[model samples]
Target: MRLHHRLKEKVLESVSSVLPITVIVLILSITIAPLTPGALILFIFGAVLLILGMGFFTLGVDMSMIPMGEGIGVQMSKSKTILISLAVCLILGILITVAEPDLQVLANQVPAVPNPVLIFTVAAGVGIFLLLAEVRMLFQIPLSYTLVFFYAIIFLMAFCTPDSFVPVSFDSGGVTTGPVTVPFIMALGIGMASVRSDKNSNSDSFGLIALCSIGPVMAVLLLGIFYHPSETVYAPSEIAVIATTKDAAREFLTGIPHYAGEVTTALLPIILLFLVFQLLFRRFHRHQLLKIVSGLVYTYIGLILFLTGVNVGFMPAGQHIGAAIAQSPYKVLLIPIGMLIGYFIVKAEPAVLVLTKQVEEISNGSISQKSIEHSLSIGIALSVGIAMIRILTGISIMWFLIPGYLISLIMTFFVPQIFTGIAFDSGGVASGPMTATFLLPLAMGACEAVGGNILTDAFGIVAMVAMTPLCTIQLLGLSSRLKEHLPPRQPRAKEEVEDCILYFDAED
Candidate 1:
């Protein structure tokens, strides 16, 4: 009965979460950018899969990821063995990132490095940074100083990196911290911080995701310079030629197994790693182990379905619709349309949910979930607007990134420390699979139409999506900090009342 109840709740939540994007796309199709019958059918079927997939995925994270990360954190921190703890964090980071489905999609797009090489390099970057994040939290290092320093390194590296490699490098940071990584990493931060029992410990729990994000940027930037990865040419996105319902079904049927195999291959490493840890640590009780096992199953199935749907249904639609709009006389409309999609689509990102909920919980409700959602929506909308403009204009991403990061970094010192942490983490979370799948493809199609350099112009949508949140969420913090600093009104005093009464008597 409880199992059924849990599943039902997740299903309902997933539908609500996914419905807005579905409506937005449908509206766009019916009015402005008409979808072919085949694409429409794919969209509808994919929507169903998305709803189901999100339900399972979120619930699975709650069950498996949160507990597992906490357990690992607690045990590692309890030992107070730095070498052992760092090694564990490093291994766990690589293993978990390797399992991220979003990264798979990203890997396929970058042809300069072999898929495995790019994937592993990004994973190593994440692993190293996750290790750094753990160390920073343990030592009580300020998130701002760390971010400013590392990002300086990233920028320096970027100068030498080929134009084609720069966007992909920054984008790797965003996608690496998606659905698979966020929950576990955030929870791990919480668990580790719990061991400290200090005032700053709660704040310390946050910035792991923040720091982990930088590692990928830095890693990819250096690799790009070394490899000198060139522009990747790709065959056009596969369009579904659905003459009938049977063909639509056939496209989806064919797509599912491929994603299923990929998701399974990804999950296997994590499963084996967990089993090894369990054997050595024996941290979880029987009931807990059984529950985690169940959750992993849900996570696997959910990801397979989700990836299959997005790749099959959403990607083709995004490409076709984007090309159509860009080719039309009204090409400039891409900016607003992109903005509209950005505002809604971000809320659907699975990792964004993880970050917001975690922020609210960690802050003890000082940061409300509704406020985070609003901030993220506004930031991402602006980002997509900026990205579309770049796609049309062929501007360097650095034109925006340098100024954006400067503002964010400057605001960091002005806001409360925790807000800075959450803000950076929000940047990472906001650019999950949706940005990779829908928005990136949209930018690519438009880039193709405009005859712009796809690599340099269209590819930084994820990075832009990631950048805006750093500024906006910190602005939320800055706002809250100002409100707290506002002068308090004077209280009514008995002495003042007496003085007033005496003055009245004297006047009389």
Candidate 2:
């Protein structure tokens, strides 16, 4: 396809993805929760930017990040020495993660740990686990066993860790695997798997994201145990007040520079790493290199626009709506309302789009993208409903999380191996910047209105969003497995049956 043609297609897809949420918010504003004019205007503006940003971002990933990651992974697989590949993977993990925008948002939310402290700790955790993931894939190890073992350790630590930190720890896992991390990690896994001629190579390419998610949770839980910070308070985002169109425009314009810098910081390390790999391996020709550079430029601009829109434009609207709903007599509607929003909101997550497309490609259309989308939507709806329940009743997050994880883990054995990997990865992908920028703020707003403990009640929405996909997608896989095993219908031994079989055979 021509470049302009492709870009248009992507933008249109983004529109389909973002439009539902926009309509939902608009309806809520008119009926149940009236947003300030300024906030509503900002939200409409943000939704437009979100559509454009996703368009460019997904196209850029197709043009650059996926190729770069796959090329590097292929080269590493060809390396004669194991030590060199391991060292390189560790460095790549840490470098890419340290300045991740999602991780920064997460760090800022938790005032207890210094930003640098939490950021680096989570980065290190990703680095170590990424290395472990590579080894497991290379050695042909089963993904389920590793997940089962690590999760056991994680839950044990959760029991010992401070109560306030449990939700944050799980939230950390969701935020760490954001737009920047998922594409590269997933592509790298595919490249690594390409070298293996075994039957499990395709399935093995999937579990890297699953393992990487575990690291942050485990690391944060350990931090809770040993690193004692005096303040464990949660700081909600400050919503901007705008009185006129000029002020709204000014607000977004002012945000551009800040987000540009943040996006630059996030992309710089990946660019540098890509350059180094290109120099060492000479992987791309002149035309390919030019294309990659163009793609990088698209990625840079797209991310800046995306971050600015969501953080500046959407955050305030989400907060105000939640607060308004919570204060009203009809607060009981929060559960169904949240579920409705969650159903469409996952489509707006950039990483989720990347994951669904990749799954479809890898499965050669055996697993349709529509099916994955529906499953994730169902899962997120349930999760957000659960989160709403927690906010209303002030229930312990552990009460839900324990059973959810246990069920997801138990389901892993019954599903196909490929589904197991995709399920866990979807869990991470479903809870990206959209959940953080909008859903978390929404939860916090409602929590504050109800006079509940924000740390305990509002903080675990992302974790819940992350957890449900593991079970729902696995259930999807289990259904497919059963269908495959069912006995084939015997052709009726009659003239009509013979004629039908003969007709189909003739057509073939």
Candidate 3:
């Protein structure tokens, strides 16, 4: 009964998140970019699946992944040997990232690099940086200094990297930290920090994702420099033709097994790792173990449904709408339309829900999930608008990213440390499967319509989405800091004022 009630609450949250985007798409479909009846029906079904998948996913993460990650982190932190903890962090990071389904999609896109080579390269980068993140936390080092140093290196490499590969490198960073990795990584940070008695412990829990994001960016940048792939190709998603409701159902039906296999593959490592830990540590009781087993099942089902819904249902509709808008007389409406979609779209990102909830809990409600969601939404809105400008004008992405990172890194010095961590983490979480499947396709379709260089323009929308939240969420932190410093006024009593005046008069 308790489980039923929790599931109800989670589904309600998913409804609130997924409905806005659905409504926005519907409005666009009927008014400007009219979708076929079958396409419209598929999209609606996809939205329903998304809501259900998110509900199950969030519940499962709360039950299984969070506890498992936290348990492992606490056990490792309790170990006296630093080398052992570092080794464990590295191994876990590599294992989790290598199997990430989003990373696989990214690897397949760049033809110059062998898929295995790219996958392992990105995974190694994640493992190494995750090690470094742990080292920083162990030594109680400041996150700002670390961010500044690494970003300086990243920019230097970006300048040296081939023009076409720059966006790919940044996009690699965003995709590698997909839905599977974020929840575990964030929970691990919390567990690792829990052992510390220092004031900085809570703040330390966040920057792990931030730092992990850097690894893939740097790795891909280096790969680009080495490969110098002169002309990267962009393949627009093939929009499925749905003439009948049966065809739409057939599309979803075919997608289910494929996603099931992928989700199963994606989840196996975590499950195996958990079992090993359970055997070694016996950290959980029988009841806890049974609940976790149940949660894993929920997570499996959720991911399968979520992936199928997005890839089969949402992708075609997004591409169709984007192409329709770009081909219209009021083509420039793409900017505002993209911005509106961006505002609601991030809310539907599965990982964003996990990140925001964790932030609220870690901050002890000092920072609310609603505030984080709003910040992320505004950031994504701006990014999609900027991306549309690039699609129309064919400008280089560097113009935005360099200055954006500089500002974000500088703000790291000004804002509270916890905000810096959450901000960077938000950047990655905001660009999950929803952005990749829906927003990227939207950009691609628009880019195709405008006859723009899809490689240069459409490829970087994820990077842009990943970049903006750093500044916005940190702005939220800055506001929080200012509020702390500027306390509310309390009116002085008339008696006290009179007493003070009388004393002054006497003294005079």
On TM-score, the candidate that comes out on top is 2
Error of 1 at 367 (Å): 1.3
Per-model TM-score versus the true fold = 0.94, 0.96, 0.96
Worst 10 residues of 1 by lDDT: 229-238
Residue-wise C-alpha lDDT for candidate 1, range 49-122, written one tens digit per residue = 88888888888887898888778788788875699989988998898887787787788877768989888888
Q: What's the C-alpha lDDT at position 9 in model 3?
A: 93
Pull out the clashing pairs in model 2: none
Q: Give lDDT for model 3.
A: 0.91
RMSD of 3: 4.0
Model 2 TM-score is: 0.96
Q: For model 2, what is the error of residue 438's alpha carbon versus the real structure, in angstroms, after optimal superposition?
A: 0.5
Off by over 4 Å in 2: 490-508
N/CA/C clash count, model 2: 0
Q: Backbone clash tally for model 1?
A: 0
Candidates in order have lDDT scores of 0.86, 0.91, 0.91
What TM-score does prediction 3 earn? Answer: 0.96
The deviation in Å at residue 472 for candidate 3 is: 0.6
